[model samples]
Target chain A: MLQSIIPLAVDALANAALIFFVAVGLTLVFSVLRILNVAHGSFYSIGAYVAASVGLWIVGAGLPDWLTFPALLLSAAFVAALFGPIVEKTLVSWTYGKSEAVQVLVTFGLFLILEDLQRIVFGIQSVYQDTPMTMLGISEIGGIVYLNYQLLLIGLAGVVLVALRLFITRSRTGRLLAAVVADREVSEALGIDTQRMFMIAFTLGVFLAAIGGAMATPTTGVAPGLGADTMVLAFAVAAIGGLGQVEGAAIASIIVATAKVLAIYFAPSLDAVAPYLVMLAVLLVKPYGLFGSGSTRKI
Target chain B: MAHRTSIKTLLAATALVTSASVAVAQDKPASLDVGVFTFMSGPAAAYGMPGRQGAEVVIDMINAAGGIDGVPISATFVDEGQGAEGVISEYRRLAEEPETDFMIAALSSGNCLALAPIADQMEMPTVGWNCDSHQLFADAEHPYFFRPNGNTIAEFMAYVIYFLDNNPDVERVAIINPDYSFGHDAAEIVKASLAAFKPEVEIVAELFPKLGSSTYQTEVSRLSAARPDVIFSNLWGGDLENFVRQAAPRGLFRQSQAVFALGESSMNNVDMPEGVIVGVLGDGWWRSPDAAELGAPEFAEAYQTKFEKAPVFPAMKMANAFMVMKAGYEKAIEANGGAWPTDEQLTAAMEGMTIDTLTGSMTFRADNDGIVDQVVGMVGSVEGIEGPVLTNMVRYDGDAVLPPEGEDPMAWIASLTPDFIAAMPKPGSYE
Candidate 1:
């Protein structure tokens, strides 16, 4: 019995780690920006493409294997720095103070353009770079061998949660960002350069999404349509976690991942719809989500 | 002004007359237009692109060699990765065009099933290029539709018989397939084959994950936990690549002898570990003993020079379909006394015909299903070959594995026994 359940747990954690990155980014952007940012998933795929390309380049150049690890993080940062402020200022800023439908339509258009751009640049073939995964080696868990990189992913997700908490609570820039999130109109009235806050918050969201994509490349094959799949799942996690709640996103990621894992292990037919089923169930019980409140904003 | 006006009017009238004459010429012309469907994107593209490439080369070769009795052949390629609805819409649109003569459609079985009824409705001569589903023609046969390749029963039966013969002591078995009709049908056939040949063997686990899914981490873990002696799967294209990539790292191959039925299609692109059983669905291995002996090496070299990749099964399937088309055109022309034949004559020519392909021969049975040999083998990294190639091969006679004309396939398999397999060719004996 333990043998059976041990693999299930490991699978759930690995699944949860990937979900946490995208969900956290979506939740983070919604918390500060008050916009859903429907194109957030494009950032994730771009990160994956960049990471795969960079990792492949490093290996091709005969660079040391250890550099591949840092290359993953560097690729994500590069995508964020390049696409974050540009998209946030030009396309995303136009959707501000608009209706929800307008925001969705605009960002959705951006998503379509980005998807086409990815195809043009990377072509239609799948890109895989597993240097980091190979370097991590494998471990036996309950008679089943697993990539040690998978375990490291679970640990890294936890560290991100803690580090984000510390940064938001302790740092000066983090406090200003929080101040902007708390009351943007008042903060702007009080001479807080709210434009910089929006730029920083949006860039951070892109970085988070990109990091998720980069980290996942070692285990999964990066292909077309990945952006759309990631976007839908991230939306489900955000909705189940009350949209803009950070801790709620973390907990909701596990719930969604667990539901999908259970469906795969037991009812294989329902694997595709399992996460959405949980989302529907959670929304039915709590209309405002588990952590959401009526008037006050909290993370 | 009067001279210019008269000149413009004459030019317009002349243009209208020429356009009308051109339209009439095309209406009475004898050429055939076919819509060849295959995947051209994603990991499946790795396999599907070869089919498209083969079609291009074959059409060019056929046209140059006097195309179908001097009526030039034309093809419109459609990508099947756009889902079923788009494929059906494209089929309808193409069928509506007056110039379209036939359809060499569909690399996917799901798309084939979706387009079958539409073919009947449109009354288009549609040929399934690589469907391989036994159920497509099981219920009702469309007069206009045909498959000149072996079905799932013939393909999967070959795998089971080969494995059972190779490992007579095998006991436990497991299955992992794409969660669709193709996957489920293959599992059923494997189960039926095992029951007929080795009833004592236990099926420990059966898994079916969604098609085109990017990850197989959980499924791999499940297979590892099951600890079966042999694992059979029909997951092809991107799903197959992803499975191999993930499962190899986890030592899934070390635990059990894996059987990937459509494995040969990915030999060039993926680094499949040695000793895993893989096969081209039919006798489509470009490097097979028959192919090597019959001048397939020069053709393969030409293909590699043209496409920068070796020809996989889909390429061979497409090339064979072109050969079938060529045979039809040649037969029609011969019957018409050396003149371009009409659509009816071409269709008549294709009925009840056999043609020699690059690898082997394909005979269109009475029901329009093709009887072609089933080739199964294992991945062997041979010297001088740039990538892995299928070795230890056994080519099962197409007629031996196929069900009798108008008989139920499942019932046919149920009536078989171990003695039946003993009568068939042994593993690695094809040479």
Candidate 2:
């Protein structure tokens, strides 16, 4: 059991790293914007497409191989920079203070449009740019050969978790965002430039989602329908963690990934439904989530 | 007294039916409008687009040759990436069109199963180009629906025989297939075949990932940790490419005798290490010796010129489907005194017919299932070719592996003995 559990745990953490990037960003957006961005996964895939294209171009142009690492970050920033303001100012802003049904319907429509746009831009064939993944090579853990890149994702997720916490608690803009999350009406009353706050928070969410996609490109193929798959999993993780709870999202990602990895390992038939089953059990026991509160919401 | 129709009324009904049959046998459209259904988008498109291109090029060639009885063939491509409901709707829409004469119904086995009953109901002539699931015709029969590309039973059973022969010392095996009927059915066939041939072997792990899953790291870890002597998967299109890309770097291929059932399609698109076992499901290899003698090399070169990549098995399967369609049309035309053949006549032409293809010949049995050779091999680099191609190929005669007509396929597999495998052709024996 110990031998088996060690590998399962490593697999779970590796899986969780990818899921956490999108789930945390989703919960973060819901925390401040009070809107569930259904199209959030589109940003993730767009970032992936941009990263794959840029990485391929860099390699093709005979640039240094190490540059692919920074290119991943730059690709995420590029996606957020290009799409963040345009989509928020136009489509997502309309859903502000609206009913959840309206928000979902509108964002679902946006999701479809963006999915088509990706096809038009990237075409239907899958794109692969694994310079970053192949560069790091492989490592043995728990008697299993693993990609060092997979371990890097785990470490990056941890760094992002700590850095995000620090940003929210210590940074001025993060404090303003936190204040808004605590009491939106009061923050607006205190002349917080609520409109600017919405843009900044939304853009940051996009950045997180995009980076998640960008980092994933070295391991996975960037293709159509990726956004929809990622979005569904992210939604499950956020719900299992309790919506709008960042740390809750983080823990829930691990739980969900573990459920999936365990299913793949033993109950192979249940791989697809494992995350949902975990969500069902977690929600049944705690209406809020592992780290979420019933009465209070936190950023 | 039983409530029965009057003699006059019965005579009238019989006459009307006779007239309808006669009209179907005699009438032929000036042109054949075929509905070619395959994937044109999404992950499956990696396989589907090649098939679609094959259909296009083959039809263009036929048209350039003045078509059957001077009727140029035209095609309307319906994307099978849409679910079965949409595929059925598209098939029905095309069938309803007076100009549409026949259909190369689908690349997906799921869609093929759904459309089979509808074809029989509508009396439409349909051919399944790449429908590979053994379950398609296990319990169901369709007169107007036929598959020229063969089924999963022959395909996966061949792999089991080939693997057991090459690696007699293998103890444990693992399978990670896509989560679909195609994947699950292959697993069942492989396991059943193994149990009959080598009862001592143990299956250590089995996983069915969701189709089009973008990542396989966890599955890879589980497979590696299982420490199986053999690892087998039937994942195709982008999903297969993705798995090979991720798994190769971790030395999973080096650790186990990795077998990709549909690896031929991605040989050009991705870089696979030498010595991995790959197959094209059917004997549709684009570079086989038989293919070179049969002019398949020229077609492949032409395909590369047009599509920027060499033709894969899916392309060959699609090209073979077109050949079968043309042969059926010509046979029907000849039988009907050089006139156009209706759906019934076309279906009659397809029944119990044997047609030669680019790779090999196929014989359609009474049940509308075709018997074609199954090719399996290890990947190796040729001196002049730019990429890896199949080496150490063994072509198993189709009839030897397929369950006899009307027999329960699984039960027939269970009844086989080790002597049965010993008597069959061994690897590299065909060459």
Candidate 3:
């Protein structure tokens, strides 16, 4: 029984690690900007494509394999730096103070354009670069061989969670963003540049999502429709966690991933719908979400 | 006045007879318009693009050689990545054209099943280039739709027989296939074959991952924990490549006797360790001795020159489809006294016809399902080959493995015995 349970737990955590990155980023964006960025998933896929291309180039050029590690981080940073500010300024900011329906439509249109752009640039075939994964090697856990890279992902997820919590609590920019989240009107009246805060928050959100996608390239294939899949899962996690709670996103990621893994193990037929099933049940009880309050604003 | 009216009636009768005679003898067209459906984009394109490229090579070859009855083949390519509804809409749009001659449609079994009836309704002659589902003809008859590369029963059964021959003592088995009709049908066939051939073998785990899934880590771990002696998968295209990449690192290949039914397609794209069981699903192997003798080498050369890569099984299959189509045209023309044949005449010509393909010979059965040999082998390092090549190969006779006409396929598989397999050809026996 213990033997069986160990693999399930490990697999669940590893799965959760990937989901948490996108989920947390999504929650952060909604918390600050108060807009559901439907295009958030595009940044994730772009990051993955960029990371895969750069990593493949590095290896193909006979560069040192360790460089792929930094390449992953740099790839995410590049996607966030390139897409985040520009998108927020040009398209995302235009929907400010508009209806939610308008924001969603605008962002959904952006998502479609980005998806097409990716196809034009990257082509439709899947891209794979696993040098980083191979470099880390494998380990035997619970009598099942596991990728060391997968374990690294679990640790990285934890590190990001801690770092994100501290940044939101301790850093100056974090405080300003939190202030905007708390009361945007009041913060603007108190001399805080809400526009700049929204940009920072949105950029940070993109960075989180991109890093998640970058880290995932070692263990998965990067393909054309990846953004849609990621976006749906992130939405599920965000909904289950409540729209604006970071810690809730972390918990919700675990719940969703565990549901998926468990379904794969015990009921393979239900694997595709397991996460959504859990979300449906959760929402039936907690209408707002696990962490949401009707009137209170918390980040 | 009565005499004048009689003369006018006689002239009108003569004109009607002349027009009827002209319609009876079909006029040769300026060009033969063909609608070729394949996946030109998405992860499936990893498999579908080669089929498209193969069509181009074959079409170019046929047109260069003066085409079928001297009519140049003008192909309109439809991407199946657009989903079934879009594919059907495209098919209808193409079929509505007065000049459309043929359709080589559908790389997916589901799409094939969807379009088969439509082909009949439209009375259009369409050949399934890569549709491998046996169910395509099991329940219904589609006189207009024909598959020349056989079906999934022969394909998956070949793997089971080959694997059991190599590992007679194996007790446990598992399957991880794409979650679709192709995968489910394969699982049923494999399970039925195993139950008949080796009743004691326990099926430890059966997983059907969604198609185009980027990650298979959780599924891999589940497979690892189950620890089956043999792991059989028919995952193809980018999904198969992804599985191989992720599973290879986690030592799944090293742990189990992995049998990738569609492994040959991804050999050049990914690193599959030596000794892993792989096959081309049918006799679509470009390097087989029979294929080498059947002009596959020249076709492969042309493919390499144009695509910068050797033709994979899908390409070979697509090339074979074109050959079958061209042969049908020739047979129809011969039967029509060297004139252009109508659609019904073409269908009649293709019925029960046998023709040599680029890789092997395919014979259309009474039901329009094809009979083609099944080729199975293992990945091995050769002295001159740049990548892993198939070694220890066996060619299973198509007729021997295919169920008899009008019989339930699964029931026929269930009736098989160990003695049946014992009498079949052994590994490396086809060299």
The lDDT leader among the candidates is 3
Go through the candidates in order and give the C-alpha RMSD of each one to the true structure.
6.2, 3.4, 1.6
Off by over 4 Å in 2: A1-3, B1-30
**lDDT per residue, candidate 3, A119-150, as tens digits?**
99998888889899999999988898899999
Descending-TM-score candidate ranking: 3, 2, 1
Report the candidate with higher DockQ, 1 versus 3: 3
Better of 1 and 2 by DockQ: 2
Docking class of 3: high
Residue lDDT tens for model 2, B1-431: 23355777788999999998787566555778899999998899999999999987888778888987888888999988877889999899889988888899889999999999999998889999999788878898899999997689999988988888888898999999999999999899889988999989899999999999999998899889888999989999999999999899988998999999999998778788898889999999978877777768877877888888789999999998999999998898888778778777789988999988889989999999999999999889878988788988898889998999999999999999989879877777754
lDDT of each: 0.86, 0.90, 0.93
Candidate order by decreasing DockQ:
2, 3, 1
Tell me the TM-score of model 3. 0.98
TM-score between candidate 2 and the true structure: 0.96
- Residue-by-residue lDDT tens digits, candidate 1, A107-134: 8999989988998999877888989999
First chain of candidate 3, TM-score: 0.99
Clashing pairs in 1: none
**How high is each candidate's TM-score?**
0.93, 0.96, 0.98
Output the better candidate (2/3) by lDDT.
3
lDDT of 1 at A132: 96
